[model samples]
Target: MESVSTSSVMDILNLLKACCSQSCNYIMTYGGTFSSLASEVGQLKDKSSDVKRDVEAATRDGQTPRSEVLGWLSSVQDMEGEAESIERKYNQKIKCLCSFPLNVCSAYRLRNRAEAALATIRELKQSAEFTKLADNLNLTRSIKMPTTKTIGMDKVFEELQRHAKDDSLSVIGIHGMGGVGKTALLRRFNNDFPSETEADVVIFLELSIDYKLEEVQKSLFDRLSLTWQDEVTHRDRATKLFRVLSTLKFILLLDNLWEPLNYQVVGIPLPAPPSKCKIIFTTRTEDTCSHMGTEKMIKMECLEEEAAWNLFRNSARMDVIDADKNVRIEARDLVKECGGLPAALIVLAQAMAPKKTWEEWMHALTIMKDTPHQLPGMTNNVFSILKLSYDRLSSDNMRVCASYGALFIKGSWIGKFNIRNSWIGEGIIDNVQNVMDADHKTQFLLGILHAASLTVRVHDDYFTMHPMTRAMILWVQRECGKKENKWLVWDRERVEEAPAAEKWRDAERIALVWNQISDLPEAPQCPNLIFLDLQVNKFLRKIPNGFFLHMPLLRILELQETSIEELPVSIGNLMQLHYLNLCKTRITSLPKEMTALVNLKYLSLAFMKYLRIIPDQLISSLRELQWLIMMDSYSGWKEGQSCEGGVSFEELESLKRLKVIGMTVSTLAALQNLCDSPRLAPLTH
Candidate 1:
C-alpha cells in the first residue's frame, strides 16, 4: 500500500478547493468560498427541482449525463482525498484477501467496491485543474510473498519466457492447486520478468473468482493512478475511464480465480487481433484455465527428484563442500534415506544435520519409522518402506540380515533420512569376520552399504537412511540380544515382508544377529538384490543353491550358526558372493564343490562346536577370499586320518592377498610362506 502520503493528500485537497474557486466564477462570479457558497449550492438545489422533471424523464429512459455526475462531485470537498485512501486500502485488502472463494454475494461486494473506485476516479477526473497537474501513474497491487529456489520450476519459467519472447499471445494463465507453487511460481516469474517495456501498464486485480466487470475497472483505475466520483452517473465513470486508457496498453493480471471468465465485466474495451494486451491468472481448477482461453495454460506439477533433493540440501544447509570426510560420508547416507519429497526431505535433513553423531542419527531414523508417513503427495504412508530396503539386499544374504533386526521404537518425530551408519562402526564384520583387506575394510564397507541400498543419495556426498532399516537392526538385536548379551534367546523374525514389484525400498545399513533364529525362509527371486546378513541362526541347517543363482548383486552373506549345518555342494557357486560367515556351526566336512567360489572374500568357520574335515581343493578355488576363520582343535586328530589340507607354500600362490586370518587348523606360513594363520585374530585385528 502507498500509505497515503500527507503531502499528496494535501495537494489533492488544495486542487479540489481551487476547482471550486473556478466553478464559482462560471455560475456565480462573486462568492466567498465553498463554505460561503452553501447558499448558492442551495440555489442550485432549488434549480435541481426544476430540472428534476427533465432529469427524472431521462433517468426513466436510462440516460445519465456527465454534467449530472460533475454536479454531485462539485458539492463534496472533505471526502475527496479520503476517497482515494479508502479505495486504495480496500484494493490492497481485496487483492490480498484471495479471489477464488468469492460466492455470488462476495462477487457483488467486490463489484460494488470496484464500482465505487470507478466513481471516485470519475470524480477526480472531473477536476480539470487536478487533471492538468497530475498525469496519474497507476500502481500495481497484490504484493508477492517470499519464495525459495527449487529446480523443477526452472522448466516452467523457461516455458513462460519462450511465450514472453513470442509476444503473440494476449493472455497467459498459470493454474494449479494451493501450495503447489502456482503463486510462488508467478511471483518468481513477475520478479525476474523482462517484458515490462511492451505494456504501458501492468496491473494486478483480485478477480473475485469471477470477473465482475466493475472489479476489473477498479483494479485498472487503481493501477492508472486514476480516481472516480464517490457518487456519480455511470456514463461519467465510463467516459473518464476511456479518456484515461485511450493512449495506453496494459497487461492485466486476473489472479486467484475459481469461476468462468468474462473480460467485459471489468468494463475494459476489448481489443481486436494483436490486442497488444494481456491478462494472466492463477487458479486451482483446470476449468478456470480453459474458460479463460489462456494462450499458454500452464499447470503446475510437483518437483521431481533432483529438485526435491536440492530443496532438501539447501534447506538443511548441507552443502557437501564444507563437510569433513567422515561427516560428508554421513551426510551422503542421510540424504539417501529421505526420498525426494520436498517437505519431508527438508524436515528430515535439517533435523539430522545438527546432530552429527551416529547415535543421534540412529535415534532419528527409529523415530521416523514408527511415526506416520506424511511425506510428499500423501500418496502412501511408509508401510513397506522397510521391506523395500530388505528386497534390495542380495538373495543369499536376505534371511541372515533380516533375522538380525533391532528392537523397534516409536517416537514424536521420525524421518527415515536422519540415520547414518558407518558400515565399519555398525559391527557388520563380527557376523562376517572372514572378509577384510588389511588396508581399507572400512571404506569398502561403506561402498558395499551404498551398493546394497542400505544408504541412498541426497547430493554428491550426502545420503539418507530409512528408519525401517534401524527398526530391522533393532529387531534383530532384540532377538539375538546384544553382541555382549550372549545368554539371551534370539527368536523374533527380523524381516516380516518383502517388497512387491511396485514399492519403495528402505535404504538403511544393517548387520546380522543370527544367534536370534532357528530357521531360514525360502530363497528370494529378486535379481537386483545386494547384501545378505545371516550370521547366527543356531538351528539353520540347509542353504538353497538357487539362493545366489539369480541375485548377481549378492555381496555379503553372514551365517554364524554353522554348528547346525552341512554345506550343499552348491555353496561354492555363489560367484558374486563377497562375505561368507559360517561361524560356530557343525559341519563334518568341507565339500570339494567349494572350489567354485572364486569371488569369495570372507569365509568364517570359527568357533565351531565340533570338529570338521576340510577339502584341500576348497582352498585352491577361493582365489578372492580375503579373511578366513576356522576352529583348530576340533580337526579330530585320529591316527591315520586323511587330512583335507596339506598343500605346500609353493602351490598357494593365490594366498598372497590374504590379510586377517581367524583359523584353527590351516597354517598360512606353511601354505603362503607367511607366519602361521592365527588361531584367532586379535580382538582389534
Candidate 2:
C-alpha cells in the first residue's frame, strides 16, 4: 500500500464496524422478535375474537356492525396467519447453527420481517379499542295508510299539490264545515305522500277534540324508535325530539283540529326557511287556520250539481235510481234536497236504495223534506256527525241562534233583516236598547257563524242554511232529549190529516204548513206549546172552539194563508202570545176577546183582503205591541169614530213604543192621517 495515510485507515475500520453491527443484531434478536410477534398477534387475535363476539351480540339485538370494525377484524386474521408462518420459520432457523452462513442470513431476514409484522399487529390492536361496534337498524321512517275511493277531489288535490311544491308554504290548512269531507280529504292526502325525494319520514295524527302533549310525544317517540324512558320529564323528551327531528326531512299530517295546537309545547320544531319539513291540518272553522299560522288554506266546498248527482247515484243503487222514469224524477228531487252536500247525498241515497217503487221514493222524499231527522240514516249518521259543529259553538246565544236559523226551510234565502228581527223578537238578542248597536252585533255574530261554516252567505243581505246543518239542529231539538217529540215540524208535506193527539201533548213547537187537512184537532192538550204554526193549510176552514184551550204557554201563533173566516172566542186565551201572524187568511173580523192579549209584541195581518171589522180598542189593547204589519190589507181606517167597524188611526197612533208599522192606506183621509202624525210617519212603511 504505498504508505497509506491515517485517514484511509480510519474510514476502513468504521465501515467494518457498521457491517458487523448490522449482521450480529439481526442474527441475535430473532428469538426475541419472534416471541414479541407471537404475543402481539395473539393479543390481536383475542381482540378480534372479542370484537366478533360483540358484533354477534349486536346482530342478535337488531344492530349492524360498523365497516371499520369488520375491516379491523379481517386485518387481525391476516396478522395471525403471518405470525404463525413466521414462528414456524424461526423455529426451523433456530434448529441450525448460528455459524452457518445460510442459516444466519435466513434468520436475519426473518427477524426483520417478524418485527415488521409485530409492529402492524400492535397498530391493529390499538385500533381495535372501538367505542361503538354497531349501529341500530330498527328505526322506521314512514308508514303507509289505507286508501279510499275519491271523486270530485281532483281539483282539491291539484291545489294541495301546488301548495306542497311551494317551499314557502310550510303549514297548510284545510277548512270546512263538519261532515263536508274534511276528514276524507285529509286521509287521501296522507295516503299520497313521501315520493323519493319528498320526505324522509311521514306521520299522521288525529288531534280531535281530545289530544294531550304527552300523548302526542309518546306517539312520535314510538314512531322514531327513541328510548322512551318513562321516568324522563317532558322537557327532556322534547329536547330529544328536537335533536332527532332536526336531522330529518319530515311531513306531519294532522286531522280534525278543533283548536290551535301548540307546537312549541309539543316540541315539534317549526318547519321553514332552511329545513325540509311540512305540516298540514284539517279544521272545521277558518279561525283555526288563522290561529295555526297557516301559510295556505284550502277551503272545502259542497260538491257541484253534476258531481252530487253522480255521488248519489253511486251510493244509492244505480239500478234503483234508474228503475223507472218516475223514480228518476223523484231521485233527482231528492238529490236537489241534499243541497249538494256529499255527506247528506250519500246517506240519503243509501237510505233510499232499498225502495222499489216511485210511491216509496216519493214518501221518502216527503220525509226528507219535512222531517229529515226521521229518515233512516239522517239522525244517527248525518245529523249526529254534524252536531259536533253546533256543540263547539263558543256561546249559548250562538248555539241558540244557529238552531233558530234552522227554522227557515232548507235552500231558502233568509233576509238578514228578517233574521235580525226574529232574533230580537224571540229574546235571543236581548238587553241592547240601541237599534244600530243591536244590528251591528247581529251582523258580527252572523259573520262568526259564516266563518264557522254553519251558515253560507248568499249575498250582502241574505244567507242560506245548509240542509244537513238544518237537519242536525232539528235533530238536536227533537231527539236529543228525554221527550223525543219536543219539536214537531211537519211543514210542506202531504199530510192528509193531523198527527195523533199524543204527538202534540209534550210538543213545544209544531209546524204544519202547506198541508191538506180539512179539520183541526178538537182539543189537543199542549201544555208546553210555545210556537204553533198552522200556515198554508188551504182547506183549513175553521178552528174548533176548544183548539187553544190547553195551550196556556203559547207565545207565537201563525195561521197565515188559511181559509178561516172568523177568530174563535177562545183566541183571546193565548195571554202569552208575543207574535201573531194571520196574513192572507179569509178572516173578516177580530173577536172581542182579543182585548186580553197584553204581551203581544208582533202582529202581522198582511194581505187579509177580506178583513172589514175590528172590535173597538182591539189595536189599543196591545199595550206592548212594537211591530204592526198590515200591508195590502186591513186599510179600513177611521179618524175618531169607529163608524165603519174599522180600526181608528188614533188607536194606531196610541202605540207609543211602536218602531215599525207597515200598512196600506186606500183613502186620502187615511194617507193624510198617517202623514199628519209625525210620530207614526217615521215608523210607517
Candidate 3:
C-alpha cells in the first residue's frame, strides 16, 4: 500500500497556521467585514475534519481510482504551498518598506502573487469533491461556562448542596440582610450545580422590586426562544408560557426577590411531586421565602473578622508586608466598621484604594465614624455604608441627580428620559440651553451613579435605586432640610387631603401620586414650588381657585387619573409651566385662561373620554408647545355648536415649534391646511 506524502502533510499544517494568522491580522486591521467571502472561508475551515476523514477512508478502502484521488490531493497541497509563499513574501516586503521609501517593483510583485493565490483558493473551493466534503461535515459551536469563586460561605454552600440532593426538597430559600453576599453565594451555587447534577435546563432571573408580570413573561419567552404574537394579552402569554414550562424538567433560580412571587401568576408551573426539578430563591427576609413556600431555608451570615479583613485587603490592594504598623491598624479598624458585610467592605475598600497615605486613610475613617448610622426612615445599617459611597461622588451634580432619583417610590422603576425631562422642568440642570444639552447632562450623571454602584440598571432605558441607596438618599434630603428640597409621598400612602399652606411654603418639588387624596387644601403660599405631581388621585374633586395664584414659578403639574371636573380660571398664572399632564381626567373643557402659558412645551390630554372640547385658541396660543398628546379625546364635536370649544387645526400652524402630535383621524384633519407648511414638516409620530 502507498503512504501519503510527508511533504503534503507539512504543507497542509503550515497553510492552516498561515490562514489563522492572516484571519486574525485582517480582523484587527479592517474589523469584521461580514462579507460572503469571509463566511465561505469560515465554512471551509469547519469542513477540514470531514475532508481529512474522507481521504483516510478512501486510502484504506483502496477501491476507487487512486490516480484521480491523488491528483486532487496534490493540487490542494500545491495551492496551499503557493499561498503560504505569497503571504510570507508580502509580509517581508511590508516590514522592509515601513522605514524606507516604497519599492514599487517589490510591492507590485507581492500584490500579483496575492491575487494569484486567492484565485487558486477560489478554484479549489469550487471543486465538486470539496463541496461534497463540506456538505458532509456537521459543525458545532461551543460556549465556555463562566468561572465563579466565592470568597467565603463554604458551610452555606454545603448545606445548599445537601438540600439539593434531597429528592423531597423542591424549593430552597437563601435569605440574608442586604450586602451580606446573598447574591454571590447564589451565583456560585448556580455555576456549580450543572456539574454536580443532571438537569434539562437552568434559568436565572433577577427579579427587581418593580418587575411587571409582562416583563417577566417576556424575559422567559426570550430565554426559551418561544415565539409570542404581537399585542397578546397577559393571560394569553401566561397560558402559552405555562404550556412550555410544564413539559420541561428544569431548575429555576430567581434572585433579588423583594416580595413573595406567585409562580402561577408569573406563568411558572408547580413541580410535580415525583419530579427532580427544583426551585431556588434569594431575598433579604426569610418571611418572603416562607411566603413563597420554600421547603428549606438557608440563612446567609456576614463574614468572620479574619475573612472580612482578608477580603478588604485584597480589594483595596493593600500590601500588609510593606505597610507601616499604624496604616495596618487603621485599615483593620475600618474593616470592622464594615460590619462584616462583604459588599460594604469591597465598596469601602475600592473607594479608599487610591489613598495610599495613613493620613488619607485616617480621614476616611474619621468621616465614617462621624457620619450618622441611623437614617430617619430606615432601620438598617446598610444605608450608613451606602451613604459613605454617595458622599464620595465626583460632583454635586452627581449627588443631586442620585438623591433626586430617590424621590421615586422605593421599588419603582424610573425611565432615564422621563427623569431628564423632570430635571429640566424643575430647573435643576444648569446652563442647559436646550433639551439636547439637558439630555446629555442627564446621561452623564446616570453613568456616574451606575459606576459608583449607587443605582442598578433595570432595562435599557430604565433603572431602579437600591433600597439601601434609596434610604440613604432620603437621609441626604433630611440632612439638607426637606422643607427646602423635595418631598415625595407615593404608592400606598393614604392622604385624605393635601398639605396645609405652610407645609408647602418652602417646598421646591412635591409628589403625592397614587394616593387617595380627595381635595387640595389652599396652597397659596407655595411660592417656591416648581414641580407638583398629584397623579392617580381618583378622588381629587377640586382645587382652590387661589392655588395657582402663588405658584408663579411652577414648571410641571401632573394631575392625571383625577376626578377634577374643571380647571380654575387662574390656571393662566403658571406662565413658567413647561409640562402639563391632565390625561384620563374628567374635565369637559380647558379654561381659556390656560392659553396664557407661553412656556408650555408638553401637554397631555390623552384618554379624556369625557372631553368634548379644547378651548379654540388654547393649543395655538402656546408658541413653544413641542409635544401635544390628545389621542382618544375630543370626539364629540358638533357642526352647529360654537367654535369656542372646538380647536381649529389650521390655527395650530402658528405653533412652529411643535414636534410631536398624538391625535386620532378626526383631530388630524386639523393639520390639512398645514400640510404644505415647512414649519410643521418635522412632526414625529
Candidate 4:
C-alpha cells in the first residue's frame, strides 16, 4: 500500500510540472486566451509541492501520510489531467499547418481548429471547481486607524458627516488656510463613514501639486483590488475604471488638492442622478471649490481660545500641577500668538515642553519678541511662532534641509531625487562615499522636516512646503548670520536689471528665475558663487563673453526655457561644474570650449529647436559624463548646415561610463550604430 501511494505522489508531481510549463508557454504565445487558467495552474503547482514535502516527512518519521494530504494530491492530479488534455488539443490544432499546401483554404481551416481549441479551454476553465482553492488563498485582514488623536474639531467633524449623508450632494468641498486641520477632519470623516453608512467601497488619495490623471486612476485601481496590465493605454484604463465604479456605491476622499481637479480627465464618472458615488475634496482656496463644482462648500475655521489652549496643553503634556498661575499666564500669552491655528499651537507647545523652569519660558518669549517679521500679509505673532519651532531643530543638517525647501516655488512639487543630487553637488551631504549613501541621508533629513510640519509630503519622494513655512525658512536664513549664503529672487519678480557687482560677491547660490530680466549681466566679481539658476527668463538674449571668469567653484547652472543664443566661452573655466541644464533654448551650436568641462556628469540639451549638430570632438572629452539628454531637437539639416556637422555615432564609443541617454526618434539610426559597436554595446545595455 505504501509503494502505491509513493507512485501516486510521484506521478502527480511530474504531471503538475508539465502542466505549469505548458500553461505558461500557451499564455505567452496566445496572449489573453489562457490568462484566467494561469492562476489556477499556479495554485495547483503550489499545492502539489506542499503535499510532496508532507509525504517525505511522513516517510522519514516511519508514519503514513494523512488522508487530507492524499485527497489534495488526488485533486491536483485531476486538474493536471484536464490542463494536459487542453494543451494537447491546442498543439494538435497547430500541427495541421505542417501538412498545409499554404493556400487560403488551408489557412482558414487551421484558424477554425484554433478557435475551437480556445473555446474548449475557456469552457473547461469556467467549469473547474476553484472555490476550495480560492478559500485557502484569500485571507481576511483589518485596516488600522490613525493613532494620533483629533482635537478641537468636533463641530467641524459633525458638519462634514452631515454633508456626507446628503443624497443630492455629489462633491463636497472643504476649504481653509494651510495648517488649519483640514486633512485631519477629512481623515476623521473617512474613518467613521463606512460604519455609519452603506457605501460599498471607500478610497482615500493624496493629490500633489503636479499630479496627473493616470496616477489617480492607478490609485483607484489599487484600492479596488483590480488587476491591470502594465501596457494598457490611458484611455483603456479610464474606461475600465469607469465601468467598475459605475455599478458600486463608493465614496472617494481626496486630500491636499493644490488646484481644481477635473473628474472627467481622471476617468471618474460624475455623481449624477441614479449614481450613488460621492467625492469629498480639501483645498486651500475657495476659488478651487467653485472650479471643482462642489454641490456644498464647507469652510474650516481655527479653534477658539479655550479649545486652542486645550490642544496646546495636550500636545505639550502640561497638567494642572505643572501650570501654576504665572505659567498659565505665560502659556496663554504664547497660545494667543499662534493665531488659533492648530498646527502652530501643537508644534510650538511641543517645542516648549522640555523647558520646565520659569526662566526658560521667559527666555523663549524674549526670543519671539526679538525676531522681526518679514512676511507680508502674515501676522507677526504667527511668524514668530513658526520661527521658534525652526530654531528648536536638533541638528544643523536638518535645519539646512528645511531652509532649502524655501528655494522652490511656493506651490511647486519638489522631486526628492533631484533635491538629493543637488544636495550632494552643493556639499550639504558630507562623508558620502557614493551616491547611495547620499540618498539615504537626504531621506533622513526630509523625514525630520515632515515630522516638524515644516513640509508636506505630496506623494512618494515628492514634497512641498506650506507658504508660511517657506517664509519662516527665508526669515531664518536672513537672520541666522548667513546673509551671503543665498539670494533667492523668484516668484516671477520683475527684474529690469541685475544686482550690483558687490551684491553677487558674497553669495554662494543665486536664483533669479521667473523674472523679467532681458539681458545677462556680466558677473566678473562673484568669487564665491557655486550655483546659478536663471530659468524661464523669456527675454534674456545671450551670455556675454568672459561672464564666468571669477567663479571657479561653480557646480550647477540652469538656463532652461531661456532665449540665450549662445553660452560664453568663459563657462569652460569652471572645471568643477557637474550639472548644466540648457533645455528649451535657441542655441544654434555648442562652443568647442565646452569640451573643457572635464568634471561634467549631467548635461541636458532637450528641446533646442535650432540646434543642428553636436560636434564629435565635444562628445568624447567628457569621460566622466553619466547622464546625457538631447531629446526633441530639430534633427533635420538646417538651411546652411552640412551633413558632416551632425552628431556621429563613433563619438559615443569613448563614453564608457555612460549610465543613461535620452534622444529623439531622429537619432534611432545613430543609436543602432552605437548598439552595433563592440566597445559601446555594454553601455547601451
Task: Judging by lDDT against the true structure, name the best candidate.
Answer: 2
Q: Which 10-residue window of candidate 3 scores lowest in summed lDDT? A: 134-143
Ranking by lDDT: 2, 4, 3, 1
**lDDT of all predictions:** 0.48, 0.79, 0.67, 0.68
Please tell me which model should have the higher TM-score, number 1 or number 3: 3
Name the candidate, 1 or 2, with the larger TM-score value: 2
For model 1, what is the alpha-carbon lDDT of residue 285? 56
Residue lDDT tens for model 2, 1-685: 6356677888899999999888777675557677778777767777788889988856643456888998888888788888889888766653546433356667678777888898898898778778778764455556766643456778898888778767878899999887778777777777776465457677888764877788888888777766677898989888777756665677888888988988877778889754468888999888989998898899999888888888888775668666599999998888888887878888887788788898998998888776777777777777877898888899887887787677766667888876776666566655453456567878888888887889989998889899878877877887563455787776666687988888899898887868887788888999999887788888999999988888999987888888999888888889998888888999988898988999887888899999888888999989888778889988778854536657777887787767778899988877988899888887787
Off by over 4 Å in 4: 1-402, 415-452, 460-462, 479-485, 634-644, 665-668, 677-685
TM-score per candidate? 0.33, 0.70, 0.44, 0.44
Best by the TM-score measure: 2
lDDT of 1 at 73: 44
Cα lDDT tens digits, model 1, 567-648, are 7655655667766666666776777877777877666666765545665555657777556655452333221224334443
Q: lDDT score, residue 152, model 3?
A: 66
Candidate 3 stretches with Cα past 4 Å from truth are: 1-385, 388-400, 415-421, 427-448, 480-488, 635-645, 667-678
User: What lDDT score goes with residue 160 in model 2?
Assistant: 86
